[model samples]
Target: MSTDEEKSSGSGRLLTGVAWAILLTGLWLWGRGAADGAGGASAPTTGDVAAVGRPLGVPLPPAREPLAPVGPSRVEIPSIGVSAPVVARGLDAAGAVEPPPFATPDTVGWFGTGTRPGAAGAALLVGHVDTSTEPAVFYGLSAARPGETVRVTRTDGTVAVFTIEDVRVVGRDRFDARKVYGVHRPGRAELRLITCGGTYDGKTGSYTANVVVSAYLTDARGV
Candidate 1:
């Protein structure tokens, strides 16, 4: 429900296979050759690139009982020293979740129409890794380690505390919408923090992959 400063910025059965092929083809076109051109100033290392697609190793905790849904107002990651205001955002014309604008690069955007932070589903929060000129709110998001905590304060005066379970980079080519954005476990409240990652192509002006941090609600307060 908050406003930002002025700035600039499915399916089943055998028929699903055809849809997937088309989608994958589109991703390849949009992100092709992203891995090329090495030795650039900011090119990610081979280790960094390889780590993005690795399976999660963090142990999952016992699923917590569900809580009432609450609109998130802020997010904090103590280990990473991130504390930022949160604004609700909707899908863009491309049907992808839109992020906060460059003008307010420090703010985090929550997918308002989806699951709320403390509810029994995966609540998504996204931000920019960097703007055209400099690093943004989630610039250091990839450095966050599993087992760290992400706290979300809600408009209803509640705080949803989640524990990091996994952190992985998903290349546009290998992106799986259901896995990346779907609920990992039923009856549990989860949170996903995402931002662009992988190689940045100056020619195309876009990142070739996305960084995703997965967590689940472990505690709550002020309910």
Candidate 2:
């Protein structure tokens, strides 16, 4: 069965909760870096950050076989001009998908239950819009419009192109998980990109809304 998180009442509380979780992640990244001598003369590179970095061709050992020509696992939106690698991770018992690298505790990725970009079901990708000091890769996602293309590069060297269908900015308190994760009609595969958006509440420490971009897979290979 598919599991969806319940809607909340106030974005303030949700943001606060996320901030606390993200803070822990930040501390962990710092601590791990220090222990690993991240201060080395080499200077930090993309590999240093959890989900924020340049796209590389290095293969993850013991790779999961392709589920339909999964591309490079890198995503690109030509309209906004964004291209970044996406990692996949299982959800915790709490069912909360991890935040992006910039959000702290550095747990950016999607829950594995959803389909990959070119596959059958809805595929969800989550990222942080920004943090206390830096803007994230997906910060301008709310501006994407219908007809724009969202490209996914799979591990098997194929690209899946998705045409944007719509965009919405929903309050975190009212995020609708069912609508976001619900199965799609036959012949149509959906992709959802999510990121923090709207004003940031310093006191509560979270964004007022989440920017969601919905798209339908238009082109695929090896399916």
Candidate 3:
């Protein structure tokens, strides 16, 4: 691996809804609450927001056949200047997918119990938007656009090259885990990078929405 580096809450209503929507997936129980500013220290919130739906007249590459499941060891998004190590993480006591500890804000966290990157499913990775004092690894994630490339190096020594297809800042009022985290293409290998977004609310001490960057495997190569 290599270079780079970046939650929220609201009322309890947001937590319950996020938790429930994720449960419906049944593949991985990554309740948004895990990214909901758990263990937060109040850095400036992530304000970059947009949802560039697939553009017309731009043909993305076909999905490559999924490789044998293997854990990711590192990730890179050159467009956004992201290059960082990826560590396995599990569900927290709250049952939501946990992010890396606050002390290591530059590292990315993978859902250890879920689909591995380059496998035939959506592999989930998360990172902090900010800490008590500064921006974290995924601080610029929402700035990524479709057609951009995200490379994930796996334990098997393969680099999964995923082409970004969608970038959405899902608001609390419109959060949907199945739509946000579920596999977009059933047979394709997918990857999702998530973090807190929207305006930070002092009332709840969390962001008002989440930024989700969705992509699929278009190519793969040796490390």
- TM-scores for every candidate against the unseen true structure: 0.73, 0.64, 0.77
TM-score of 2: 0.64
Better of 1 and 3 by lDDT: 3
| Structure candidate 2, residue pairs in collision | 25-105, 26-105, 70-154, 70-155, 71-153, 71-154, 71-155, 72-153, 72-154, 73-153
TM for candidate 1 is 0.73
* 2 versus 3: better TM-score goes to: 3
Which should have the higher TM-score, number 1 or number 2?
1
**lDDT, candidate 1, at 75:** 99
Report the C-alpha lDDT of model 3 over 128-213, residue by residue, as the tens digit: 77775677898999898888899999888889999998888877565545556766656778888887777765555556777789
Q: Which 10 successive residues of model 1 have the least lDDT summed?
A: 10-19
Best by TM-score: 3
Which model is ahead, 2 or 3, in terms of lDDT? 3
Assess each prediction's global lDDT (C-alpha) against the native: 0.65, 0.53, 0.69
Candidate 1 C-alpha RMSD relative to the actual structure? 12.4
